[model samples]
Target: MDGDDRAGGLTRRRRWPWVVLVLAVVVAVVVAVLFLANDREPEAAPQPADPEVVTLPVPTPTIDPIDVEPGTRFFESLPRTVLEYALTESTADQAAVASGAVEAYRLVLGDGGTTEVVVLASQWRDADAAGAAFDELLAAEAAAAGIPVDQVGTPTGSADDAAAGEQTQDPAAPTEEPTEPAAPTEPTLEQGPVEVDGTQVGRYLLVTRPDGSGTVHWTNGTALLRLDGPATAVRDVYAAFPL
Candidate 1:
């Protein structure tokens, strides 16, 4: 089922900022923005890339027990940066994205004792759909947090993740500090933890109207995930999910 069509009762198409392919330039832009945001200090070179691939199942999105961890039942823990970078690396191959179908995961992690993380891992129906949604999600997130964002032309192809590389980490990777985005803008932001159903969410963002809820939400094939929490816990959430 399409992620947008899952809501049976009241479903309506909401116009979101059009997302182009997740290309090299786009990734660079995102990286530049993160740097400008002072999200991190000059750190030692990125751990020697242990280019590896970790595949997860494609499942529908839904709330699970709070005690139980989020994401698919397959992989135990995957980090945000690794997944993001892998997706970036996979796009370098044009022929790959053109005639390829990968079973991957879409994850949204943040720091928090009770924040909700949405890990939408699945096989995308096509490259176009994957790239479009991936870019759109990035734009929406930037706008919500008032992070300056500009759309760029799609170069070659831009879809994240692939079966190309094995997912492995340099055991020497830094685990001490969590790289945090600059304080996000809050047209509607709440502090402290809140309860949803029977679970307590540390924090969450209600982006400008038409901006609905959920910290991060996207779909690939039959899989969808919406992980959200407070702004304060964003860093923690990202750190919690180590690929």
Candidate 2:
């Protein structure tokens, strides 16, 4: 029995060396696989970059700096006159345009009391110039402005003296009595209040005859342009005019 035990022990010892050799081979194979995996390149998926955005500047609106009011522009279109009168802020009211109108027109004047037109104005050199201009525009070549006659006054005198002078004249006589013609009626002006730099500088309304029609009229500047309708019509004359 002892000899058999010793033979079994020898066989076990020989198998132990082969097991150690097999373990060493398995460890070497594992290390080689790990090194190869580390050295190999990794796969990557490409992603697109975010797009860029562009911005533009917005445009701004434009505005007119001038007074540009219809009435203001009406006066402004005329020849240069007193700055105050030219620059004066005026209301554009509806006016009546007589059928008799032309390129050079005379506006039928308006009365402040009864008519819708303005019978008074400023900046003309004189009444003669104003009337002359009106007449020229009406029946002549110059631009016509409206002129209005306001009130017809009664002359102060004795009717008896006129009757006695008439009675003395002989009806049978061929010669007629010479008499001096009465003076032409002049417009009596009523002034408006003028303000200069916040102080009073009394301004006044100018009076003129309206034309063939006995009426009154008013305006601001010289070299008149007679538009024959209402204030809106005056504004309608130009589309660019600012009302």
Candidate 3:
């Protein structure tokens, strides 16, 4: 379900901003054409002028995953935590955010190593819900791994601060970056990864390296989650949920 936001006497869809921008572009092109025609120099009254026509491109908004399929089973079965994070977290990448669903799996063969994969779906009630669900899923995934949930959750703010720093301190800027009113804000919820069973869950791959190991994070409006190590196994599992 698309979440509803209302105030005063006016009611508008949550997705209206992108729509309005596209329309503005269309209006501009139309006005430009009219003005050009009005200023055309007048020719001799008796001479018939050849007709000239111009075509302008109209703006088209990109479609979200939710628009193509709303409330599909792919979205319904998604773990709540994953859903929460996708809707809330601002750091989600565009490809993941655009995807309407998420899928990830690891094959724990009797062998020593693990095979894994993860995918996110892009369909949801709204941004708020998507963010909340994504964070929750990350917590659950981390818990499945040996990592302490606190480590995952505790990093939320610091990660956000780091992200904000990157957004503001663009290298292209000549002087110190000035903060603007429209600058991206930090996440609303406190979050971190979880310990899955006793193992430290890597959203993509759990590593035992000289440095450190962790999962990969991916998210979208309707889907968000982490995958620990390798992608093959998780990718296979994700395929089943597409119906």
Candidate 4:
């Protein structure tokens, strides 16, 4: 009986070591799986892409004001700055009296005196005198250009006449319904009857000189004006001029 008991004890002890080894292997597998799961980073939540950026444009200012004291009423009424040009000088010229003008004024305007514009304004006794003077000036300019006076510009109806429409009907004819007047066409550079704000103000003449500079002449009421500057700059100044 003793020998049988000793053999059973040895078998039970060997079975215990096998069971312990199996438990150890199971624990090692569980720890390895836990470590691997902790090491793996979670997928970053899908980030929304940055919104696209857009840009817009800026507008330019038309008028630029400056500080200056205009000596005469005519000069005082004039704008200090016409677009980019500034009025830099104003003077009453007695020499202009020789030309039959009651009052003659000269204005010097420029972009820092780099691009210059010289304005000569003269007031006359009456509309007839002004008209005659304008004709003489036109003739002089035409002769300087070596062209006929008519070629300079053909006289067109005033802005008032144009806006009202010309009406001519025979006295014997029956009256009909009046129709809407057609829109007045805008005049271009070197064109007759210069207009401002859709109204014919005066006749325009551009005279190119031997040099790059040029002269622009126009009449307003009892006053005649002449502007001299670089050809391109003079055009801009004339367009920007209020009177």
Candidate 5:
């Protein structure tokens, strides 16, 4: 029995090379199968990006920075001498575009009650300039309304005039100057243009007439130039502002 076992061990040693070759062939076959299974069509090419949209800015006359509540006594009780009104903020921090330190404006005309003439702006030098522009605009619009610019009663120098004229029994009465310094008053919004800092981006809706359409313009914090005419109709003239 011992001799027979010895012969079997010798025979198995001689066949080892054949066994290794068979194992190698089996591995190769499996790898080929896997490779074929994983083979697939090439991926499609990436699509190109779309072109950017371009829009041109439209300009118009500037207005005061103030919010107007519709159908209110403030709207109905507007002075006849006042064509429009606004209460612009001294600083953009208190304005709609305060986040950008940009100037803003709103207008309310004297129709049956108050018709918002035009309100759009979002860039300026400072709030004081905005207030100044409001005064100027009020004066201009009043002049257009056949009232003398001097009699527009701009709330200049002191802010108390805003309260004096606003809460007074007479909206047409001249505002008395304040005797003592008071805390800065919130801007009073009347329908008209508001001033801005020397360095401001102003766009406006320049209404030629209450019945007729108006033009729009842009300002480099200086001159007001017409950027759009009757052919260019826009809902919000300031929508075309780049700022």
Candidate 6:
């Protein structure tokens, strides 16, 4: 072979090896980039959270008082004075039928015509009838006061039964010694029975109105009575009332 041809062949062999090395390096770089891309994790999209729920309490309903016109019959049974208040006006034969009573009377007593006290008296057929009527009246009063009926009064026993000592004890049942009533755990809306000389004379419910006035309803014998006046004065008037 000629010298020139041999030199050219050597140069070509060296150039071929360099080209193969460059191709190998490029292939390795491409494989590394693909592997890294496959190993990476994708980011997740954000989602909305559930809305919170809230509950509210219901409110008690209010009641309005009923009005009646003055009647003609004389209310002779009503007391002339209750504490410092004096009877100024009276009416009868107005609420008898509605109250399920044989007779009904209403009396207004006040200081100098200011109208501080009002008295309502009704007579039923018997103690049972009066008690039923009293329950109805108390329920109405409780509704007007926005309180539960159970919170109105706690009658130990009927006035007639307690007065007569007629409550019979069950001989077969175990006799438990009288225990003092537990102190009330919660606030009471009204008082319980009215006692005189350790005898339960009646049950009274004292409910205050929105105008700051008060009402007292009680039952004695066959009579159901109600007294309305100042929040502080009604209790005194009710205690002084004879009915």
Compose the digit string of candidate 5's lDDT tens values, residues 97-137: 45333434333322233333333333445645544554455
- 195-236: candidate 3 lDDT, tens digit per residue: 346653322222222223333444443344444333333333
Q: Which number leads on lDDT? A: 4
The lDDT ranking, best first, is 4, 6, 5, 3, 1, 2
Model 4: lDDT to the true structure? 0.72
What are the C-alpha RMSDs, in order, of all predicted structures?
Answer: 40.4, 32.5, 31.5, 18.0, 21.2, 20.0
Q: After superposition, how far is residue 190 of candidate 5 from its true place, in Å?
A: 26
**Model 6: how far residue 76 lies from native, Å:** 4.4
TM-score to native of every candidate shown: 0.25, 0.21, 0.23, 0.54, 0.22, 0.51
Taking all chains together, the TM-score of candidate 1 against the true structure is 0.25
List model 6 lDDT by residue over 11-77, tens digit each.
9998999999999999999999999999888667777788878775432113222334544232455
Q: Judge candidate 3 against the unseen true structure and give its global Cα lDDT, from 0 to 1.
A: 0.42
lDDT of 2 by residue, 1-243 (tens): 899899999999999999999999999999999999998888676887888887754322132122434434334453221211122223332332221211122122222223222112223444445444454333321112212322222233579989998899889979868899755354322223334467643322322322322222222223223332234322222122111
Q: How do the candidates rank by TM-score, highest first?
A: 4, 6, 1, 3, 5, 2
Weakest ten-residue segment in model 2 by summed lDDT: 80-89
Once superposed on the true structure, which residue ranges of model 6 sit more than 4 Å away at CA? 1-77, 153-188
Q: For each predicted model, how many residue pairs clash, with residues at least 3 apart or on different chains?
A: 28, 25, 68, 0, 30, 0
Give the CA lDDT, 0 to 100, for residue 31 in model 6: 97
Model 5, runs deviating above 4 Å? 14-18, 37-39, 42-115, 118-243
Better of 3 and 4 by TM-score: 4
What's the distance in Å from true for residue 184, model 5?
Answer: 27
